[model samples]
Target: MTEAPGQITAETPPRLVVLISGRGSNLGALIEACEQGQIPARIVGVVSNRPDAGGLGFAEQHGIPSQVLNHRDYPTREAFDADLATAIEGYAPDWVILAGFMRILTPGFVDRFTGRMLNIHPSLLPKYRGLDTHARALADGETEHGASVHFVTPELDGGPVIMQARVPIVSDDTADTLAARVQRAEHRLYPEVVRRVCSGEIQWSGRILQADGTPLGAPLQLDEDTHNASPPQPAG
Candidate 1:
């Protein structure tokens, strides 16, 4: 099993290596959190599978090191993962964060980070595990939908969820509308989860997840009103 990131302290914040494939809105949130001292962590670098990912520019603007290892250049997933892992390990990251990173990682890559990796899924998870979550949720007439932040495991999005924020499904809500709300929730939820992880308030021992040393059989749900506020802060 991979070791957890070193406990964060005021003098030594946790180091994060974020991976992105697109706009990286979640990445933006994390950057803001670190800058504002909301989380005791530093985003050491940002890596993207696409050379033209917009997140790379955002990283550069903030003076954060950024790298691109285009997936198309590699012949196989394992090959790409090998190179990717090498690039990430070079930074000596305390945590590997997938913020909209659009690649299905190989087991080798997943195992390298194991307990020290995290991802934000746009859905409530264990519901629409794959994609098109907004459309699916709306079509099913679900009354509630939102986002989840979970540990990264080899079973795709099957990892245990740490925290979730729910949005009420309104009448005549389209996929696009619902997705916008969910994205807003994600920006708030993901950073709080990262904060908790870095503070050692939440952790995974083997496959079980715990918060404040108490086992959490299910993901902790956040009150949408309070948790979805601007510039998320640590939950008490």
Candidate 2:
């Protein structure tokens, strides 16, 4: 199988097509990162399933191409995904990023960009896989909870993790408070993972994740402390 478009050489920055459904603070972060030359990639376009998504406005303000294909207008999930894929492929992105894209894509749609797409979830994988993650974490009396960035797979939140950001669940933290902290961490974590992916330092080999050609066996962790530290040395 051919490598995903995410696999990039050192010479050119990766091209990105970011998808969003809401306000898209993460999308804003990406746009800032690209502008500041922090992440070695370019967001060529932003697509939203909601016509009124705020991110589209952010994209326009920054002069990035934006599009809306309301999922509600489509007859079925597969049809929506087909058109969505076509719209995204038009940009010829090296990666398709789901930055708070709330839709659950069809299997065929996911397969079309299997190894090239990515998503960031509000909770650690194998844990609060769906919504209300902050509430769930608080209710569970979890001492620590955070966000995860992973490859997009047909199984919801089941793809091999690329990186994670962990934060302490304080004694009196409510869902909103906890979510705020996690979002800050996410703004840091997601770009770093993208940097690694763009630098050819880490990659998905269809089934497993590898750093420098060696299997990771599990996703790399990026806690609050290490979030600012140098990137982890690849395991031998």
Candidate 3:
């Protein structure tokens, strides 16, 4: 199983170390894709700040190594992130992904990884850059909402945008419903973004991101109903 001679290889598919803190549905998506020979990366390990995170179970079930560094066990955020970096670095991952990981990273740690780390946020980004993005978008009367894949920087959700898939803000959409829809897009978008990252199809240089052979352009505008004219039901 040899991958193309790019950023990743079959023997080493840009070893990924995922960080998760909850249901890990996105983590599960990544694992499933890897098992099915979809993405050009492999999960070297999974890390969580909470031991009870259900994603840890998913990783263990798939035989992917996992670790927990309880934030409560540390005295300060910097100390905890330092330990987290140490543990994740132990696996020598080419990239680190935040899959539902709910911790604000320190500039020092983010600087360490720079363009090698990424995160998935459930909003169009630059629109809603912080927590509760789903509810925030709806409350703001946004016409469309979606997920963003971006380089993880020191600023909260302020990294260079990579890819996004839009979902309509229907008349009856609620935070929960919109969130579910966004998650579905996330499952597809995150893996594609990871593949691009690992294959070198996408590159982050300075403050811009490019795909294939050229610049991807500024904040992408997306169609609310991409596959179907009618709004798709939220994932149950």
On lDDT, the candidate that comes out on top is 1
Q: Best TM-score goes to which candidate?
A: 1
lDDT of 2 at 169: 91
- lDDT for position 40 in model 2: 79
Tell me the tens digit of each residue's lDDT in model 2 across 1-236. 22355565556678989999999999999899889988878899999999989889889999999999999999999899999999998988888899999999999999998888989999988799989999999999999999999998999998888888888999999999999999999999888787777767777878768866777755678857656533444544
Model 3 C-alpha lDDT per residue in residues 1-236, reported as the tens digit of each score: 33432377556677888999999999999998877877877898999999899999999899999999999999999999999999988988888899999999999999998888989998887888888898999899999999988899898999988777788889899999999999988888787777777889777775556666567665343344452122222222
Ranking of all candidate structures by their TM-score, best first: 1, 2, 3
Which pairs of residues collide in candidate 2? Answer: none
lDDT of each: 0.87, 0.86, 0.82
Assess candidate 1 and give its lDDT. 0.87
Better model by lDDT: candidate 2 vs candidate 3: 2
What TM-score, computed on C-alpha atoms, does each candidate reach? 0.93, 0.93, 0.89
Candidate 3 regions with alpha-carbon error over 4 angstroms: 1-6, 219-236
Model 2 quality (TM-score): 0.93
What's the TM for model 3?
A: 0.89
